[model samples]
Target: MSMAQWVETYGQGTVLAAGGVLIGLSFGFWAQRSRFCLRAAVIEFWHRRFGEKLSVWLLAFASAVIGVQLMVLMGWLDTGSARQISAKGSISGALIGGMLFGVGMVMTRGCASRLLVLSANGNLRALLSGLIFAVTAQAALGGALSPLRTHISSWWTVEGGAPRDLLAIAGVDHWAGLAMGGLWLAAALFFALRSPQRSVWMWLGGMGTGLSVAAAWGFSQWVAAESFDPVQIQGLTFSGPSAEWLMRVMHWPAPPIGFDFGLMPGVFVGSLIGALVGRDWKLEGFSDGYSMRRYIGGAILMGFGSMLAGGCAVGAGVTGGAIFALTAWLSLVGMWVGAGLTDRWLDGGAADKPTSLPAEGFKRP
Candidate 1:
């Protein structure tokens, strides 16, 4: 029987939840092993040392682009039906929100994914930051800050009925996302492999993580299309999913859990397993009130920014960009610029602060 047919037989929730757990496990493992962080990747791309980290990201994105596109061609996913396809993601939101997210990641010394992994390793700071980020993101999505985000984005939003992705924006055929995906894959691979520092596991980590993203997309698509129950077609995103997961766990079915509910904790669980395997688990906490305050502020910024930008670093920068969304690319550029600025700002003010976390994943390499 086909995968969709099998999902139907097994039940959509069961299959989707299982698939989510599997992807989350693999993603958390790879993320921990390679110390993946998009902000760090951007910094290292310009600053060196962890150029390998940036290369890892490229490999992951490249692999994901090709894998997802192939699935599209094979009819596993109707690219157009995915949530981001027709939505003209707001240009203002992508720029401003991305900048805010970049700054927040820099201040907290990790993005959402990095913080999640760190939390698994017994970093209390990360745990707190995760909670703060979740709550603040929830607020932006549906609480206090929602109106502001909605208003600004509406003022600057692109109209519907245009080409769905950046490929079309750049004068390429939007429907030829697969072909364009190949070109992008080639570019990312070329740069990544060209790096002098090469490790087998790092490559495996990158490739594996990317394949997880691809598999998530395909699997989500299949279930959403084939299942009797309602499902949202999505892939690996951190911020919103993090909030959704937190609510379900805290509220316990007031609002039913969705695909992301399985994904969020699964990531933490998988990361914890990875830490155990690597013997990297450690007890870590804030250095002082000053440090704790910084984390809280940063988390709030990231939460709000992610909602405005339409996703977090992994959501917009990797997953959305993998499909060549214009908004994702725009958010990425804003992130690069924002991260650079934050680095400069932080460097001037606090050079002697005590480190509470291993910041190599988020720091200026």
Candidate 2:
């Protein structure tokens, strides 16, 4: 049956949730097998060791840009109404929040999405950090921290619509965007080929991770077009979704069953399956009180920073970057700089330092 028919039969919520499940599953599986982590990528780049980790991240990012731009050119997806473009943005928040998030990820040894993936693989440190991240995100969204986030966001505001669109600011069309993506893809291919540990999973997993982002965009747009009710055109984001799930679990009446409803669980399950298949599932926990404090502190910073910046690493960096959002680009730059500096200061520029829970399936060389 057609998507419209499915929506008519069941509901837009159910259909969106189902699509989220499929896309999230693909993302989780690929991210797990590829060991895709922006923190890892940033460390590799900063340490001047362009290896498998950096290549995988670049491939995923370039692929998402290419896929999303291609879809826009084909008239298959329209992102004009998406929040990343339509909503008011903050320069201060993007910069400050992105930096904080970068620092937090280095401290915790994973970003928000990475934390979730690791949690599903029996990493107790990640599991706890994920919970902390969710709670902090919730607090920033509507709790006590909301006021602080609001004040910072209001410090330097940018008008929505054309002002928030990076492509519009650059006087470039989607074709240019596609070309830029191509250049990035070329660089990724060069690095991937140079890496001695390149494998089929590296290629497929990186592309798959990126395609999942594009697929989410396309699916949500299609749903919005077909559904009678208003539906949010969104891709994968952990901050809002994490807060939503936390509230649902803590409250009585459940929130609406939209894309986020299934996305989290799907990712968790997908990562679990990947771990089992790869025999990478192993129970692990914090080694010391100092480590525990660091993880918690990182989670708190990430939670607040993601909300302040209007997205996390995946949300603002990859998803928003693909669409050429101005604030997202700033945030992405902030993350890279912040992470690099933090690594230099804290870890002494050692990217290969062992974490409390090393990414088991894929090791950094």
Which candidate number has the best TM-score? Answer: 2
Model 2, span 76-105: residue lDDT tens = 888778899998899999999999999998
Off by over 4 Å in 2: 352-364
What is the C-alpha lDDT profile of model 1 across 237-295, one tens digit per residue?
99888878667767754465456767877888988988898788989888789888888
Candidate 1 pairs with clashing backbones: none
RMSD of 2: 1.4
Lowest lDDT sum, 10 consecutive residues, model 1, at: 347-356
Q: Report the alpha-carbon TM-score of model 2 versus the true structure.
A: 0.97
lDDT of each: 0.77, 0.90
**Number of the top-ranking candidate, with lDDT as the measure:** 2
